[model samples]
Target: MNRHLLYAALDAAERGWAVLPLRPGDKRPALHGEDVCPGIGDCAGGHRKWEERATIDPDRIHRAWGDLPFNVGIATGPSGLVVVDLDMPKRKSSTDTPNGVTTFTALCERAGQAVPATRTVRTASGGVHLYFTAPSGVRLCNTAGRLGKRIDTRAWGGYIVAPGSLTPMGAYAVVNDLPPAPLPEWLSARLTARQASRALMTAPSAVRASRYAAAGLNAETASVRHAPEGERNATLLRAARALGRFIAWGDLPREQVEEALQWAGEQAGLSPRSCEATIRSGLNWSIARNGQRRVA
Candidate 1:
């Protein structure tokens, strides 16, 4: 692997927040297990290769940035970062064409409008990474929770995009000599608020405790009954956001629910088959555990 590309990815992630690099060796605190690339190429080689399996330590990335506010990173190749925008659209298949490209294009267009100097385009992997020169006088947040915790853009090593992994065509970018995108004050505030909301949702311990209290159940019982439901509900809401909807769960139509669930599954890195099972299980669990109970 070209260390330059790796550093480039790292630098990109650093623009958004502080990042920890996970490579083949060198273990200060090691992440658990070998990363499973899934349908992407093998990232185990430490260099870019075919598009079947790319691997990075998700646990480590999560852990490293868990408490920090709003950190994001790249997961595959020397130049990719994991971008978690609640605004990102959800789809059924990771390899689904047009959808990925369309989303990428849309994001780039928005970014261009937001910061004209930061022009971006699509990558072959169907994933888009927006690039910009380091802006002067702007100190980007390096922690994980600053940008509404809902959006994460960090460069850890496990995520795989196209051409580099699953897509045969590979990733492509629209290059322009553009200045770094300026972070708008209003946008930054909104993102920060969103991150705060995300923190509440992902805070497992706090959520479990709250559920137990609300359901009048003990911790152990709540662990099984309430906790998973809470998680499932949050996941579903995330799905809805990815699908670009603003309605509450009860307000969503069945078809929309199905589409959102599929998109959520893709974000979770689940296969199409797994996504189906997950959606079914989540819905069933919700009904069984909270019959006639409304989810706020």
Candidate 2:
């Protein structure tokens, strides 16, 4: 009995949150220790961890929504909470200001104290999550630019999307009433200085992985993460101008090769509002408008 995912996983396990199931309209994991993927190329690595069968147990979420119309998720560190997603960008500039509502209103003016209006949700592309709580020991990891440019931060193995869920791109509602915010000791020292500047940019430096393997671009980054779609934006502008000719030969780090060519142009689908302006205009048309034709 789905009943809106069995009363939304028993109202997110009566607000202690943990839930799980997902896979109605879709967000993967509709159970399968035995079988249930009647599609999606029959799962496998396509996705199925269901975060080790997440649960707050209202009778195991009523036998996991009695196997019907699923989608609910919400696990976030055994429910200690910590979401803050905020996505929203499809190309701003109607006078800007919407980087997830101006980075949660500049972290409530630098955590002089504010975040108390939580349990927000909304997302279905327009983006927004909010929630909070986990800050005790502080380890809040899972990040993709934690506080800017389409911000993200989902703590400890993460999981969300559960406000009465539904998806084929729509329906995650809760939109804030309040309850869940707490992590702000100056936003936990600005997320521990953004986790030490992302561990000093992924701790590599054997001369930046030998100049990022001399930008040979391993088969054009596996064809820019499987390009196709009528040559996915000219194969992601030819792999961001061969990662800007390995960052104009100083060998790399134009913000980590434009965050790995915008995560390979979002695994070749692009459209996250022009994936960071198509990798910053194909990395300034190959390092500043064809830097003297990158010297033969």
Candidate 3:
């Protein structure tokens, strides 16, 4: 048993964060997936996701962490925290690319406000996680690049590795000791806009003529949204290609299909630029191949 990790889990819970166990030196949850759920213990009622299984109880924490050197995962929704994850660009060596910190700082400057000095964690990949208290009466979901490039948020349906967690890249550690400040009004306003924009995307559903097309579109987007990290791009590409056939058959509009798939890819953690490129490529390939058959 790693006492240090045990302390870390307890400390987070002490601060009211719901904690869960992650694989040692990895970000993935240590809990069983629904596919292998034994229908006992936590899942006796049904399959409990990591978010539902997350707990603040010390006994649960101790029991889970005592047997292995498991890393800690904080379920942001249950903890009533919204964490802003500032990610580094994938191409670190390119000076042309801006990291999340730089873009976020510039965004704050444009809004005539400074970056809020809140509880902050420095991620192993040289990025930052700014912790904030979720505003009362408002439930926000996770977003990727909704604010800007390389900026993501973890709220309902999302989780983050706590300080003292280790991964192959490096360790997560607290950089600022300040208690989380209430989410800034400007940031909150932007998030609200995100919700509105998403609503607009669904407003065009009347254009969908076929139930099969609608079902296919919904299924593909859901697959992209829930895809694990390493598989996100491939899933997005495949989803776009599958939907392209519907577009060629005049069952769905190309613009609407592209927009929906793009948003799904971003929510699944792909960059906006990458999502657009992949979606375009996949749609082009599929439409070209399928359009000829339609003509024939």
By TM-score, the best candidate is 3
lDDT of 2 at 173: 88
Candidate 2 Cα errors over 4 Å, as ranges: 6-68, 72-83, 86-113, 121-128, 131-143, 146-160, 164-241, 251-253, 256-296
lDDT tens readout by residue for model 3, 17-127: 999999999987899876788999889998887889999999999899988999999999899999999999885458789999999999999999999999999998999
lDDT, model 1, position 96: 40
lDDT of 2 by residue, 3-38 (tens): 877897898788888877877878655566323444
Q: TM-score, each model?
A: 0.36, 0.32, 0.81
Error of 3 at 51 (Å): 0.4
Which scores better on TM-score, 2 or 3? 3
The C-alpha RMSD in Å for every predicted model, in order, reads 12.8, 15.9, 4.5
The TM-score-based order of candidates, best leading, equals: 3, 1, 2
lDDT of each: 0.35, 0.67, 0.87
Q: For model 1, give the RMSD to the true fold.
A: 12.8
Clashing pairs in 2: none
